[model samples]
Target: MSSPPNMSTTTTLQASPTGIRMITPKSTEEDTRLNQVIAQVVSFIQTNLCEVDKLTLNTGLDIEDSPRLIRVLDAYGVRYFYHGSILVIMGACPLNSVINTLVLNILDQRSTILPHELCPYFSSYRAGILCSGTIKGKGVRPQLRIKIPDDSITFHHPGKHTIYDTIMIEVAFSESRGDLHREMLQYFEHYRPAQLAILVKIEEDLSSRTPRTDPGFRDRAAQLLLRFGNDLGKEIHATYLENSAHDTSVRPEPFTDDEILEQIQVEDWIGTIAADVEVWDLMHSEPRLRGSRTRLFPTPDRNSVPYIYAGDMIPLALHDSFPNLNVSQRLAIDTDLLCMRMAALIPRFACWRAINFFSPEDEDEDMDYNADDDEGEE
Candidate 1:
């Protein structure tokens, strides 16, 4: 959570009416304390400080910010960003599919160059890529309006350190997705060379376990069971639907075109469904460009890619955009291998704990936490 010069730290603050947004600490100790108090109030509204339901600063509802904990700088209308989050859930155990796990290894290899070797399309320009890099620009206030893009590429000036953004990718959750295209406008407003932006939409899955507001309920139930037997506990559990929780796979939401996004000139827009990757040209043009997506995500059955793809031949290849020198060929990203590795942590979800035989679902809806991390845009 990078912040301005005066602030010490920042965290998400979520409220019912206001929604969620990151807020930075006030400079003075007293001012900071005031922020904490406000966060506590919002926390109380959201969780009532229940011992069992308390959210750890570390892993609570992702992209969360308690309304009580913000500096309310009227000067800066309203804008915030997220650095990290809990998990967006892939299969039965949401814990298995984390944002960082999906991209870190691939990101490590591509971070230094334009992600996916698109630099060659730029002719003589030297460009670089960053995962979740913060884009700083002035907004309505004194502090900088930081826009953290999921994945972004920047072009460097000839023999200079300063770089300007060219393309950006964003993984947007439905809750805050309304701001999607508007953010692209903000990026263009700040970065003069910004050309393209990709948007990825992923929805959230609900957990089934019910958290108790009363800390002493368990102990009280134990005493009651000693006298009245386990029937009471079983009855209460069944009443709350605690005994029935199933794992039904949920798919990511499809991207809906907005007036703003449509007007921005999508020379092309590609949306991957299931395992099939397809690209579409929203802009009607002469010659009619079509892309072969079969080549993007080769095979789910076979783990290996047979041949190296030439930069020019690949579908969705950036036009006029130079392919990175490193991606001349040898551009095989083992999607299957990465996926299996990403789900490697599934067993630990409840591999088996005391009374864990039927762990049923993951965390309940009331205690939902999610983050779909993607290096160069989700």
Candidate 2:
């Protein structure tokens, strides 16, 4: 028997020129152990436009960006529809690339294994009898005849459905429609699936725990479907309420890090001499202390509140207390005091990501950006 996979090494999918795909482990790990799961995963690669190296990249692979995987899926009987960068498959077919990506990400294991005996599946609607109605030019109107598939596990369909063996995939989205609920009933009555997979996608952010009343419609619809599944003696696998992972609006501005030594040196100096002199004492000793608050602190009023500094503005007051110190020694003491106060205000004035001491918002703006560049890339 071969040894267990080395977790430290990276794992990647490699496609042979002959179209056979294999998992290339960084070490000498065996493929037979994870063949079933790996094959299931390989089947999900959709786009052929991706670079060869991308198959090994750390980023999550999706149908929209992976071009080479796209071509591979086209050959595997999977079809795609694009809405901008986003790609949509016909349905949640088990072997489809999207579903495969979802399952693999959830498992989070490079050598993960899926059940070999998992049921075979497809995306199709129940087709058989056709009922016709007379239009203005048409002569005959006949009653409709619907033919349900003989498979034991089929997905419920309202014209189109994602089917696995005899089971149908049902999805619940954020918005509600009365017509969809009605159609769901009709589909459930016709195709009694032996098992089903219910996928729920909620547009709202799941990170928030704020409670709100859910309109009983979606819950009622789920209940009705679950009841139908139970009556049909089927197994139901329900997924978590999924939200969009790509949100450009959540951008956090990057800030600069403050020098750690400067901050610590300032803090220590202030702690050692905070009680030596007060602000009023410095203002009384120096004529410049009576000037505007803006000149005293130097930073803009919008970004930070101005305050008298012990290092520069209050040097005269420190000199009175430390009469033995020379000019250079007093200057050094003043600098340390200023550093401490500036470090204290860092958290309140700076961006959450960075530790900028007193930088302006304009420092974060990009100067050479173009609208056309963004449009062409999208």
Which regions in candidate 2 have their CA more than 4 angstroms from the true location? 1-164, 172-183, 192-197, 205-378
Best by lDDT: 1
What is the per-residue lDDT of model 2 for residues 272-305, given as tens digits with 9 covering 90 to 100?
A: 1111111111233221212222211112132222
Candidate 2 lDDT: 0.26
The residue-level lDDT of candidate 2 at 216 comes to: 39
For model 1, the superposed segments whose C-alpha errors exceed 4 Å read 1-37, 40-146, 153-158, 173-198, 204-334, 341-378
Global lDDT of each model? 0.33, 0.26
